[model samples]
Target: MTYVLTFLPWIVYAVLPSAHWQWAALAGLVVAVGVIVRQRAAGYRPDALIIECGSAVFFAALAALAFADPDSSLHPYSGALSSGVLALIAGVSLAIRRPFTLGIAKQSTPPQIWDHPVFVRTNTVVTALWTLAFAVTAAVLAVLAHAGQGHSTAATLVQIAGFVAPMLFTKRYVAAVQARSVPQ
Candidate 1:
C-alpha cells in the first residue's frame, strides 16, 4: 500500500481536467516533494525514494512547461510523456542492478533475506513487469493522444490499469514465492 503512495502525484495529475494541467503539474510537483520529505523524515534512504525523486524532477520540468505556455502543443501528450518518463526511471533502476522494488520490499522483509536469491529475483521480475506496463501504457497513450482521445475514458482506464495490473501482480507474485519457500 505504501508503494502506491509513490504514485499519488501522478494520479493527481491525471484526474485533473486537461485545461488545468498547469495547476495539475504544479500540484504533482508539490506532492512529489512532500512525499520525499515525509519519507526522509521517516528515515528512508535515497534508494527507497528513487521513484519519488524521479517524479519530482519530471513534475518540475512539466510544471515549468505547463505554466510558461499554458497552450503548449505538448499538453495533449502529457500522459504519454509521464508514463514514458516512468518507464525510463524503472528501466534505469534495473540497468543499475538495483530494482526499484528492492528497496521498498526490504522495508517489509526480514533483513536476513535481503541478499537471498529468491528475494532479489522476485524484485527483479516485479520491476520488469512495471517497466513493461509503463512502456505499453506510454505507447498506447501516445497513439490515443495522436487520435485526440488522450483524455478519453479509454485513456483513463488504460492509465489506471497500467498501475493496477503491476500492483496486483506484485502482491500475487510475492505471495506465491513465499508459499513456495515454506516447508511442506
Candidate 2:
C-alpha cells in the first residue's frame, strides 16, 4: 500500500498525456492526503511520511507556479521534477539518520529488535540503496525530459527498474541476513 502510494504520482504523470502533466501535481496531492487520512484513521502512522511530505511540497510549488505564471514551461519536465523531489526526500532522510525504511521496518519488526545493531544497519543499507536508485532515476528522467523525450521507452524502463531493483535487493538482503542469524 505504501509502495503504491509512493508511486501514485509518477504513475499518474506517466499515464496522462504531456498536456495534462501539470495536473499530476493535483493527482499527487489527492493521493497523499488520502494516504495520510487512511493511515491516521487506522491508528497506524504511514511508513512513508517523507514521501507524502515531498508530494505535498511539490504540489504546493506547482500550485504556486500555476498561479504566478500560468504560461510557465514546467509542464514538460513534470516527470523529472517529481523524481528529483523524491530523490531529495530520500537523501535528506538518510542524512538525518532516520532512514525512511526504518519506519516501514518497524511496523513488522519486534520492538525488542528496534535498537539492535543488525536491524539498524540493515535499514540503513536498504535506505542507501533506495536513495541511490532515486538519484539515478532522477538523473535519467531529467536527461530524457531535457531531450523532449520524457515519455520514451527508455525512460519508462528506467523508472520501473529504479523501483524494482531496490525492492528485490531489500527482500534478498533481509532474508540472507536472517538465515545467517539462525544457528544449527
CA RMSD, predictions in order: 0.8, 2.1
Candidate 1 whole-model C-alpha lDDT, 0 to 1: 0.93
Lowest summed lDDT window (length 10), candidate 1 = 1-10
Question: What does candidate 1's lDDT look like per residue over 1-184, in tens digits?
Answer: 7776789889999998988999999999999999999988987778888899999999999999999999998988999999999999999999999999998888777899999999999999999999999999999999999999988999999999999999999999999999999999
TM per candidate comes to 0.98, 0.87
Q: List candidate 2 stretches off by more than 4 Å.
A: 46-48, 66-71
lDDT of each: 0.93, 0.75
Most TM-score-accurate candidate: 1
- Using alpha carbons, what is the TM-score of model 1? 0.98
